[model samples]
Target: MSADHYFSADPAAPARPGTVEFSVAGRDYTLAVASGVFSAGRLDTGTAVLLRKAELPTAATGGTLLDLGCGYGPIACVLATEAPSTIVYAVDVNARARELAAANAEALDLAGRLRVAAPDDVPADVEFDEIWSNPPTHIGKAGLHAMLERWLPRLAPDGVAWLVINKNLGGDSLHTWLAGLGWVVSRVASQRGFRVLRVARKTA
Candidate 1:
């Protein structure tokens, strides 16, 4: 059995370069992908649902944004393209994914606004105005929760985080878990067995 996984810090699988083409908000994207990254073959269903259902930022949107677990820069690219005035930081644990994400950003002329970096490489002082992700459930409950615990607090006081989770993969439970952590999480949309969640800090 191979130890390689998309979440692996360093995937042992040889990089087989490819491309994934998908349309979002009427805009077409052809991003570079490889075997070591998440959803290398196509846009992930959960991610697609998140992108389709979430309230995407517009050209007027500014401030820093974060694309957590950004694989190959799909979400990062889209966010940067949609919000021309915003700076997007795409963070991922996988080194190969980071490389592919940076390449994709550069290819789409979004490199100026999109920054790709490994998780630890992101500046600790930076806080995001918006955060987006389709988390890795396969990492198990503890790991997933740890990932959220590490990132959710980095949101600006009024910042919002958009997430998509598979209903079969503890989507509802995750929502409740986030709420238990004091976040105000709501199911903004549900489609194709995926739940799109909008999460924000609770206001007094």
Candidate 2:
């Protein structure tokens, strides 16, 4: 497989643009997406499931939230809309995805609350109050694990991360592995063969 598989720093595919329409908590979103990004054709089913099954942030939820592997800013945009006062950081490795995310945030008039940055661009000292992701499981177990290991530790004390994974793709094994890593991992919900995992740092 080519390295341009959504996580590449730069994708060379022709930019075929389109829009994805979805609603969360009665709020509608029609965001632009294009080729060379994750789920460019539509709002990915896993992501839709994640948003629908996971507990969404409320207006009172105020703090820095990380949208890990943000593709075109869907999760970041939704988070910004739900908690207007919070800072939503959308981090991705793909430059095209970052550009599209910035544009989407701007289109939603959420540019002030949304911060689009490459993975390394985010300040090292900053920690997240919450982290949400529909991770790129296609990256294989080792790569996926490494990616999580790098970011999950950045969760602030008492913070949690909500993740969605396909059951067929070692979801249960991942839960076990995370538990071994000392995280408090639980199966929050499951639907259409997808598992929604709630992970938090274990208290000392």
Candidate 3:
């Protein structure tokens, strides 16, 4: 159903909240989940592959970071936790997702550096040093491309973006597509039927 997707501004489903616990980079997390958000049961496999395979930020890392389509803020939380100096913007279109992500950031004591906002709510002037995402490919290729077009340009000239897509769901084709768009794309990692792509502007 079109209404079932997490990109909806408001989900009509019953809240029916619960918790999903998972670990990242050897640290554990227990996050709040409800009926309307993405992967409320556990960490999605694509995200797991992205986190495990992509290059993670370090404490020495600074500047703005974007977690595009951040669901419950798992990637954002990990980013903020690993790179204390970075300010992370966790953007989601769903109201419930923003609320839960904000709460999760607060619970992890990362509220000071993490901002959870709707995609349209983010400040237009912010540019990211690094962008992380497990983009919603189920939205269809055109919509997915539009979402990337809207945010990818915000990456700082020296910045990089990490993205994960299901191989069976057009991963290889998406890589070719990004490359065709003038971005330097690479299949940096693959696991569990997911492709972890590193995307960035080409160097002269």
lDDT of 3 by residue, 17-56 (tens): 9898888888898988888999998888998889889999
Which tens-of-lDDT digit does each residue in 1-204 have in candidate 2?
A: 886678888998878888989988899999998888999888888888899999999999988999999999899999999998899999999999999999999999999989999999999999999999999998899999999999999999999999999999988999999999999999998998899999998888
- Candidate 3: misplaced stretches above 4 Å? none
Q: Would you list the clashing residue pairs of candidate 2? A: none
Residue 107 miss distance in model 3 (angstroms):
0.5
lDDT of 3: 0.92
Model 2: CA > 4 A from native: none
- Worst lDDT run of 10 residues, candidate 3, spans 1-10
In the order shown, the candidates' Cα RMSDs to the true structure are 0.9, 0.9, 0.9
lDDT of 1: 0.94
**Runs with alpha carbons beyond 4 Å of true place in candidate 1:** none
* Candidate 3 backbone clash number: 0
lDDT (0-100) at residue 69 of candidate 1? 94
Total clashing pairs for each candidate: 0, 0, 0
Error of 3 at 44 (Å): 0.7
- TM for candidate 1 is 0.98
